[model samples]
Target: MAYLADTYIRFPIKVRNASGVRIWDLDGKEYIDTFMGIGVLLFGHNHPNVIRAMKEKMERYVHLSNFFLDEDAEYVARRLISETGKGGKVFFTNSGAESIECALKVIEKFRKRNRRKGKIVSFVKNFHGRTLGALRITGFERIRIPFIEHDTEVVFLPYNASEVEVFMKAETVDAVFLEVIHGSGGLNMIPGEVVEVIKFYQKKHNFLLVADEVQSGLGRTGKFYGYQHFDLDPDIVTIAKGIGGGLPLGACLMLGELADIFETGEHGSTFAPNPVALAAGRVILQMITAELLEHVTNIGKAFKEIFSQFGTVRGLGLMRGVELEKRVTKEEFLSEGLLVNIVGEKTIRFLLPLNVSNDELDEIAERFSRVLKV
Candidate 1:
């Protein structure tokens, strides 16, 4: 008698507990968690520092209103802005969809105030979020067909289309949304040439570039933000998934002139900047140190080598995908004592934890290889 909505196709196993990159089912079977809570648990499950921070904050207070000043939230916002190395302001949200919603509203307001065009350009197969505004720009038509308005002023371009430069040269655009690494789009990275085209046109037209780093930010791709991997600068960055150490926390970082685009009453969230979540976010941000990023890069390389043996591999850092030669189901992988995310028909997306050690990596490889009989 399940009462939940039919929104998710959940795995069959009932998860009882998790620690680090391991999960134990109700029947007491242990499994390696390569999915890492859909790329949320960067430091892995029940991270000691994150748990401690939340516990301490919970004792003092759990919720705070937007009217009051919040030190924990301020500290997190400052750290996020500093990571981008840009002058910016932050609007906190409870999830990635809310962050995208914030970015969309801000972009619209900024463009309208400046008398710029309202049309936006987004890429095909790149997912922003599930909210109405975010879904309007999301590239998947099947999911968007029901809710998306017919008159939504957005143009969807292929990931590496030359049409971007062609279209921009002819029409003025207000903003361009990009998922530096398309997490839900089978972990496909934005091609380098496409970035060059976007950057060149951006300099001339001065259109706002928004980096949707909801899944690839906060050390998931061995960088603070996935956009940093290339030579592109973004005006607004939306982030979530990893910053709260499994709790709900998302942010829209507005840079330069757009930093102060929002007025006093423009936007607000009731549950955003939750004291407990902010406390956890502060600790998670601090833990994403240079050494941790370096570890992700090196370990990610090793993971690629292992997955490449299975089939074609794509993506960067710990955010990897393997299109295997043979089709395998999630249940089969579960039988092999591994929990991984399956994308489309044949691709397996592996989003390992940032702190996963060499020994743990070896264990995961052994289990994964057994699943494919390699």
Candidate 2:
């Protein structure tokens, strides 16, 4: 019997320790961690460099209020902004939801400054964070139904290229927030043409384009940012999950023009730029160089080849999904001792760690094939 809140259904596995591409339960059973802590362990569990950075920063300080600027935070911010290539500034926060909140503030302030009462356009199956404002913009009905009261003036459109243009043209929207590769929405991939459509509409209407890269960034999708796949340059980008090397950290990156709208006291978090988290983030980002990205791409190709035997494979890089046929049920497959995530009733999503080995991939595929046959 476990002694914790019943908020989450306890899996049979009680994790004791985790390392690259694998986790061990207290019972001494090991499993390949394809889910990768819901896409947080981008560099895999307890990477040595990340661990060393965290420990070194812990000796200096852990949590300093946002009042004082920390050097670690500045270092991370500089690196992130440089990667964006848009001369954007960054605002640090502690979680994905907080980062969304920061993005919301930026959008609202931008609209207010322009004297426009425009709506925020989101998609039909998008998943932003769970805060009130973020939830309002989120696209999943099951998650949004309970909190419908908090959402207003938000327009939802189909995740298709034609529909996006039609929606933007018809509605006076201030911004359009999307996930370049939809993670919680069942590892859905946005069409490349749809991205071109978004860019075209943004140029025509001057609405802000926001990409939620919380799950798809930091080499998760073969690129530093998922938007890179679509050749997109979003006006604002929200990042978290993998940014802090398994710590609680998030960041909102915006172009200098859009960032200027948020004046002093506009937004802040108490533990936003925690030194320990930023230190780890720095190491993780450094490790995600050209060679590591190539590794991710190669692994993604292998995932495609293996998952194709099951059914259709969707998504890019380490963020991918294997959609089992209607004949396969997720409940029936749980007895196989592997921890795969089922979304949208049929898709078995693999948020595989960036460094997952080919041998581990082979094992996962064999186990999955065996379970699928059963």
Candidate 3:
């Protein structure tokens, strides 16, 4: 018996060890891991290259404050900035929520500098994060109520292009934060036309366009970033989950003139740029090149074909959700030894790693078919 928080009473799976698309429970029962640490293990549990890099860095150092710049930190940041293709700068943090905080702070600072109390327009059912400021901007109210008093001046809008002009014309609208493909908010895919409208509004109003790619970045969505699904360039993009393999690391990439909004002391974290985590992030990114990305995409297509037999598959690349029938619940599948998660009551979210093999994908699909039959 484990002494755990009541929060976990709803879904209890005591893991003893995990590696490569599979995890073993405390009772030695091995199961395929479709959740992938909530989309953190892009290369799967204990990837060799990531492990080697982290071990090497551990031998050198572990926790160094942001006061001194580490080589790995600089390396990862440079690579990320170069890939963003927007002349952007990067600020690292320890978690996705912190990265959201950094992004919000940058937008707010930009507003303050421009002497505009602009409002931030967010889409309905978009999940940014759960921190105070991030929670304020998040479209979900169940998580926002605790900090309602401290919420920012954010306006909720439908995830469609037709409503863009009206919202942008509203007074004091400063930035637009969105997830090209909503992940936690039910794997909802934003229409390409909606993205085009956002670009138009950003050009017309001069307000910042922010893409919250925390759950959709680092090749999770068949592209380097989810925004790539649409022909658009955001002023700022936040990322986390798969960046550091399995380690905790988050980054906020700022583009155009918005990159200079944060001064030296405007934002930071004690473990933000830990060399070990940065090394892991760099190696994981290298492992997810064109070939691996294609592999993931192909496997995703296969999985979708199998999952389509059950219900609609909603999402791109490995960040997909199988919307099951009302009679089929996510918890039912999990209890049957498949490590899938619920996006909602009727949807089983599958965040496959970029390096997952085709054979493993087939096995998972077969198991899922069996479970769904039950």
Candidate 4:
């Protein structure tokens, strides 16, 4: 309902059902889906394991409020910690935006408690979420201009090594939010020099580092956390999108002593840590294991080789953007039955599933070739 609150871009097709990497519309027209509900379904639509986990949880119980305990939460939390090795303590949320909200609060509280300066430095083109705090840190000026939060202090800088080095030298910074691969910003990857600067400065500075892995995490990037590729361990990590396997679940993982700042009454969500979503999360974590990670890396490499013949492929693993030649347009791809998105002017994005088979990947590549040829 983009019109309902002016929240999203409206589409014509009304989806009915899906399995693996294919989706069907109400009239029974089928297409290979890589949009995957904007990257939430990393395991693809109606994944049997995830569905079964949620179903079993539903049969047992659903929401148990924050006051009561849910057994599945422990399993999910443990898995997150083991996967990323950063979630010393985790706060559950309903979406990635909420996870960002929680991370912002944690760092904000940490700064306030220590009497430090309060400024958030984030790169241009990196999107955290839509919540007030997350919105402030979001880099794109188009969407952020009208909804500016007056009280929050945020600094925007170019995603380059020189700019980052200069900014890290500032004492006024409280936290730095980084997205390793610029998902919405035309799938730009961070340069090695910039990654080095951040890694070195992460030690010299006391400012908290928050990795916005909402789109790039959960084995979508061939690594559990995108920042892992940078050799940078963030103080707080926000995860969502694919974590719930299609359900609305997310987490803000805090590490070390920074994990214990919030007192009992400082933060919470009533419906968060829901048993059903946690069950699905547990299953997804299990699904994206060592063997699966290796498969994703190998497949991603092959897809990049194939897509390079079409245009520039500019992202990691399943999170990719195919920059089409001037002859092709996003509208043309949509008309051709390809389900990828047009991000920026020249790029056709691939929000492909993490668990999509090799055959599905080949089919997607073949269709893109068709888009270019026709």
Candidate 5:
């Protein structure tokens, strides 16, 4: 602990092991994990299928440069494109932030190629990522203040505000980065009115819409992509978190005309298409079937019924946030043998696995109810 950097507000418990939806600490105390590795473990920690795929790929070979052709990479990319139901190319990355950076680059290149200079529209309280390019558009002022010289011109509109209508009509926007369900900034779902405005303006203005599905995509929100919940169709989409099946894999999917925005030397990544991660990702994509999505929906409904007694519940499917009437702490939840994410002091964000069972949900509900009663 002394040697490690204090970057993360480290969890008190040192995890000994995890399986399904439960974690065991160093002292052998079992706890229900609602955070699900910040929504990265779609199938829970060390899912058998994900593990088998990775092991099988490792047996064959592991690291191969992007210059070489790999079947797994091609398959994963094709599957991702197919899931979007939109014809597009894919750029692989190592994490959500890298995927976001890739999306930004696509926006820049697209604007340049078309000889159009315009501002990028992003919503306030939207959590994109932490990198410089991502932070530039990210709505958090505290984090963005340190890196103020972002250089790119971006308009930060209030999330789900009617003010967006004015900006859309007045501004020549190159692209708009949106989150169908906001993750780190509290699980706020983007409303229908805003989605309609963006869709309407996109038709009239011809600007690109980039959906940031890092936290809410790949069955996390009971859909293949979060934007599917809305009527909007994004031209560019950045994905991460559960897409790796608990490993580090991300992608920036280009759709419509923006698919060919990048040429040969324009963009690349060294470890983006790692065989092991892609192998796991391929299984993840296969496992998020219609049945699993329905399970997620039912679980979300159960969660809402339990949590609504505490306070307002926001978000859809397994992606949920409970804004309690009383302020709570992560330490309090930890004390109750429950692991959950606390955003600020009042909101508890729950990113449970898509495969979590009804019994597991009841256990979580009981644990959470106990915590609130305290």
Candidate 6:
């Protein structure tokens, strides 16, 4: 009966409106949104500042091609680079997948230019994106590999810190992909020492370290960048999800010599760096102050303490994954008016908005307790 593709696992609830951490369905039922639009709504739905930015930009212009120099986009890019404390270049895109696509081209091209092999190393159970190029680097083979193929040679390695030293020393890798906090893949963490080891070898072997911050960036990890938690500094970082404040936007941050590899007209996007989206993104980035990050860290600790009563909780900042002895199903949360994703066999992921109130989180936890009891 429907004309559109049935790509998503369709839910029956039709949301009429949402504000903050609450979503109201057509039937007038209220739900506490713990998933936070899959970690896209960093400040929650219809945030005042985000809306203000969009309104101001919309009054001027909404769309702008890559040909023109958009001021808002430039403003946001400056902040992004400054946050990293590294003077680098950035390429804007409409989504995380597109950013990865750009990174793939830039890194691969850099390797080829240097007379290096076209080999990429990423961790097992780590997710990058669903596009053809990103899928090749993604460790989950069962989802998209059958429909697509890649020419780039990719090797999936374990997330062990000790083994990374062995593997990196042995392989002739061109680029190494990392997601410091695994977002979609059960919320696994890249150990602190693993990053140290990679940093140690990256200098010795002379390889590019691409941090996939699509889901874990933008204060979601209690830091401006998820890679900041570790001692390692990535050469290329792809960011999205929360940057646009619910509108589609993403960027690839390049540092050191890797910054100027993408020549003019080499790689670009048609819908990237839109004036409206850029305005929203700029405001969101400004809103993420050190105080807010510290607040997120505190909230994560409080939530973890409460979550431990139910099961094992692991992850950084607000992007924690609770692994229950008796896993909490998505259906269970739905019935109890809570929105969360059952990431795996016994894992429920929590992607709370950065500015979510402690009261809201307490209520969600209370609801979670009741759901588990039943």
Q: What root-mean-square deviation over C-alphas does model 6 reach?
A: 1.5
- Model 2 earns a TM-score of 0.95
Positional deviation of 259 in candidate 2, in angstroms?
A: 2.6
Against the hidden reference, what TM-scores do the models get? Answer: 0.97, 0.95, 0.94, 0.95, 0.97, 0.96
TM-score, candidate number 6: 0.96
Residue 146 lDDT, candidate 1, scale 0-100: 91
Better of 3 and 6 by TM-score: 6
Question: For model 3, what is the alpha-carbon lDDT of residue 50?
Answer: 88
User: Which regions of candidate 3 fall more than 4 Å away from where they truly are?
Assistant: 1-5, 149-152
Ranking by TM-score: 1, 5, 6, 4, 2, 3
lDDT of 1: 0.88
Which ranges in model 2 have alpha carbons more than 4 Å from their true place?
A: 1-6, 149-152, 327-334
After the best TM-score superposition of candidate 5, give how far the Cα of residue 374 lies from its true spot, in angstroms.
Answer: 7.6
**Runs in model 4 with CA error above 4 Å?**
1-3, 149-152, 327-329
lDDT of 6 by residue, 99-164 (tens): 999898987788779988746898888888888888878878786568565545788888888788
TM-score of 3: 0.94
lDDT of 1 by residue, 42-110 (tens): 888998899999999999988868878778888999999998989999999989999999998988898
Tell me the deviation in Å of residue 129 in model 6.
0.6
The 10 consecutive residues of candidate 1 with the worst lDDT sum are 143-152
Which stretch of 10 consecutive residues in model 4 shows the poorest summed lDDT? Answer: 327-336
RMSD (Cα, Å) of model 4? 1.8
- CA-RMSD of model 2: 1.9
lDDT of 4: 0.83
Per-residue lDDT for 1-374 in model 2, tens only? 47777666546667899888777889877776668778888878899999999999899877779777878777888888888887878998888988899999888888878998988888888899888889998998888888785556798887777887787777788889988777888788888778888888888888888989999988888888899888887888899998888889999998858857677887777777788889998888888899999999998999998889889899999899877777565445556657767778788778887878899888888878788773
User: Least accurate stretch of 10 residues (summed lDDT) in model 3?
Assistant: 1-10
